[model samples]
Target: MKTLSLFIAVCIASTCYSQLKKLPIKKTADLHAFFHYTGKGERIISGHRGSYLKGYPENAIETFAYVLKNTPAFFEIDPRLTKDSVIVLLHDATLDRTTTGKGKLSDYTWEEVKQLRLKDRDGNITPYRIPTLQEAIDWARGKTVLNLDKKDVPMQMIADLLRKNKADHFMMVTVHNAKQAKFYFNDNPERMMSAFVKTEDALKEYEAAGIPWKNMIAYIGSENKPANKVMFDLLHARGVMCMISAAPVYDKLATVQERAAAYRDIFAQGADILESDLPVEVAEAMKQKH
Candidate 1:
């Protein structure tokens, strides 16, 4: 009996060691380097709604998983509250467009929300269903980062959830202005935030608001060309990455050549990140330029 017990203990120890070896450990400095401007201008990609047009359901964990596996990109997922106050991944106020159900998302309880199947970008019902915010957070651990786009939920509530899950390191919350940035920075200075910094004046405003520049990715909102060279230079100088969103606008550019040209110009202007509906395409374009 003693020999048998020893053998079992050895087997369990080996199994545990093997499992630990399989886990991917992301360094904090590396994650910061990926999202911050280092003057070298390393490019990053964010999948808008998790590559929804590539047959994956928008805002679904499966879609995000597919993106991380296929491309070196992070995912932007929208989180909204259900009737029971559970936060879940969703892009619209109503579930009619993305799901089989026809009602306001907040009107449905989580149990009911889980039953509705998600539709593709083309409106075809897929096997995926709405995932809870916690579910997405769990999936992102050691895999990729998630950019939380503000929907109906309060930023404080979202921050609380991130703290609960110990996921603040692997996610960033969207902030529209300096005031929002200051609000979040005051809560936890370590939290990452994405906000618009369209001009040199915007940078000055952020400084005056006491926003943490090290924990920010400035979204220089420009249609085609980069927002402003001075703005880009200032952000980079302060070690803040400049993100150019190519969605619902530049993504709809007339032709493939035009879109490609626009992306090239964005990089040439020293933009560190590209948030795109066409994440895979943008990644490929970046690769070709390199």
Candidate 2:
């Protein structure tokens, strides 16, 4: 009886690991190149607000396509879950502001939410329909990298979706703080974090938990900088990359030209990738020196 029980246990363990292994995996270079890691340059242009600066809709599929075609600029979009547990592209806690729809966004399901169109910041309603995460993945495949801004969905769902769709090759996951990162990673360590550079206590906790350093991206907002070169240095030394705004603090910057310049300067600080809303503008600026 003991031998039979042992045999069954081994079989179950083997099957579990096999399934885990089959989950999609992404190479650091495949992701690194999406940021336009030129053999000689500092940062790759990132589309801020999904090319919203160019009149493209934020978090819209068309905007993603536009950014992919115009330049190597990577795309950024936010994800929020509707009431039914279906994830949708949204930035706010409610849809009353970004959409023509009324009431709290969480009140709707993917089916119900899909009926409404997105309204631009100017109040001109776009023809684009709301798309699910799978649709977004299909849109992005072989074209651009996805900077996933996880807002509402549970981390378990994110992991399950990645495992189910085998999507790790095209997307990077981020958490606002280290505690969230720990919860997500601990639940399923197979997933990865491109950035979680918030607290040393969290960092120490992560290290102590035996999670490998290579799995997390590092970031630090410098007072001298939004987060200075030290952010890059710390992460680079650990063999991971750092995060910077695509066109961070654009309104605060003295001028659009200065904002574009900041993108490159962040790259020069040793950042492997940059996130920007003004990708086309910055791309043009970078082209001048070439």
What lDDT does each candidate get?
Answer: 0.79, 0.63
Q: For model 2, where is the 10-residue window of minimal lDDT? A: 16-25
RMSD (Å) per prediction: 6.3, 13.0
Compute the lDDT for candidate 2.
Answer: 0.63
Question: What lDDT score is found at residue 212 in candidate 1?
Answer: 67
Per-residue lDDT for 1-290 in model 2, tens only?
99999988986643322322111224654553433323354455556557664245678876666555556655667788889888888878877766778887799988899899887656678877677888887766655666677687788888788778766666767766667677767765645565556555656666776666656655454222644554455555556556666444752477867766665566665665566665666666666652
What is the total number of backbone clashes in candidate 2?
Answer: 10
- The alpha-carbon lDDT assigned to residue 34 of candidate 2 equals 39
User: Taking the tens digit of each residue's C-alpha lDDT, what string does model 1 give over 57-102?
Assistant: 8888767655665577787889999999999999999999999999
Query: Model 1 off-target regions past 4 Å?
Result: 1-28, 254-258
Candidate 1 is scored at a TM of: 0.86
